[model samples]
Target: MSKTTITANGQTKNLSLEPRRLLADVLREDFRLSGVHIGCAHGACGACTVHVDGVPRLSCLTFAVQCDGAEINTVESLGGDDAHHLLQRAFREEHGLQCGYCTPGFLMTMAPYVEEMAAQDRMPEDAEIRHAMSGNICRCTGYQSIVAAVRLAITQRRNGESTQ
Candidate 1:
């Protein structure tokens, strides 16, 4: 077993795990962060997307040991039932999810793009939104609602509305 330290959901943890253990497994099985879903396990699906050091990564393709000393943020870190992030609220308001299996990954993957666009004080075009969201796949909703949700979040952020 290897010892590694990771800050997940704003909480730091030192864990002993197999060197080859996947970050998805560590987050889900070890830490009980069930929002990190493992769908394709091969990283093609992006179902296990998470933020590692403020950048989106495929948790299924990453080793826990590789993330040592990194700050990780899963969907759980975004918000809770009482207070929802703008993206989450937009997703709900726009009906971005159907089965909801892919919502967390989609949220994780699109968050940085939304934040960057907000900082730039611009909303992405439809084509740009599609390009940015190409990594994540959703079997339901046909992506229109997801794109709308992202656009809504970007608009909210640009308007200086609360996003967290």
Candidate 2:
């Protein structure tokens, strides 16, 4: 087993894992962070999405050993007493989730895109937003509400709110 240290949700954690162990397995089994679901064990589905060094990646396709020294964040870390991220609040207010299975991945992926949109002072054009979110698929909500929620969060962000 290889030893790996990762900062998850702002907390440092250490674990022993096989070099070939999938990140999804290590996260759910060793860390007991069941919120990181494994959907398509292949990389096709975004269900196992997580942020590694602030970039979204498919956890199922990533090796635990490869995550050594990485900073990871999951949807579990997306909210706080300081405030709910604008995306989280928008999702709730806009009813962005149906069964909610894909919500976490959507949030993880969109967070960065939203920041880019604000930084560029360009409202994410529909094509850009769609392309950015194409990797994640939602079976239950038909994607309408999800897109709406993202748009709502963008508006809130443009109005001077920090969603991250």
Candidate 3:
């Protein structure tokens, strides 16, 4: 077994895994982070999306051993009484989800992108937002609400408002 240490959510997780164990399996099976779903089990579907070192990655395509010393964030981390990420709130306000299976991926992927845009003092243009989110495919809500959620997040961030 290969041992790896990864910080997930706000906690550190040490895992002993088989060489071929996917990161999604480790997060869900071993660590009990079921929010990182496995959809395609390939890199195509964003259902296994999570943040690694503040960037979105497809956990299904990533091996657990490869995540040694990495910082990972899953959708579960966003839950709490005071937890109010803009995307999460915007999702609710804008009704951005249907069926809800793909919502986690969309939220996790867009969180960093919107935060980056806010840091740069620019909101992503519609085309830019679409292009940036091209990898995530949602079969529900027709994506209009998803786009609205991102826009709302950008607006709130610019206004110095915290969803929490």
**Most TM-score-accurate candidate:** 1
Query: For residues 1-37, could you state the per-residue lDDT of candidate 3 as single tens digits?
Result: 9989988887887778798999899888877888888
Encode model 2's per-residue lDDT on 56-147: one tens digit a residue: 99999999899999998887887753328889898888898988888888888898888777777678766777788899988988777888
Alpha-carbon local distance difference test for all models: 0.91, 0.83, 0.85
- Per-prediction tally of clashes: 0, 0, 0
Q: Which prediction has more favorable lDDT, 1 or 3?
A: 1
Off by over 4 Å in 2: 80-83
lDDT for 13 in candidate 2 is 82
Residue 151, candidate 1: how far off, in angstroms? 0.8
Answer with 1 or 2, whichever has the higher lDDT: 1
Output the lDDT of residue 137, model 3: 85
For model 1, how does the per-residue alpha-carbon lDDT over 114-138 read when each residue is reduced to its tens digit? 9999999998899999999998989
Off by over 4 Å in 1: 81-83
What TM-score fits each model? 0.96, 0.92, 0.93
RMSD of 2: 1.9
Candidate 2 residue 162 C-alpha distance from true site, Å: 2.8
The best-first sequence of candidates by lDDT reads 1, 3, 2
Kindly report the root-mean-square deviation of model 3 from the true structure over all alpha carbons. 1.6
Question: What range of 10 consecutive residues in model 1 has the weakest lDDT sum?
Answer: 76-85
Model 3, runs deviating above 4 Å: 81-83
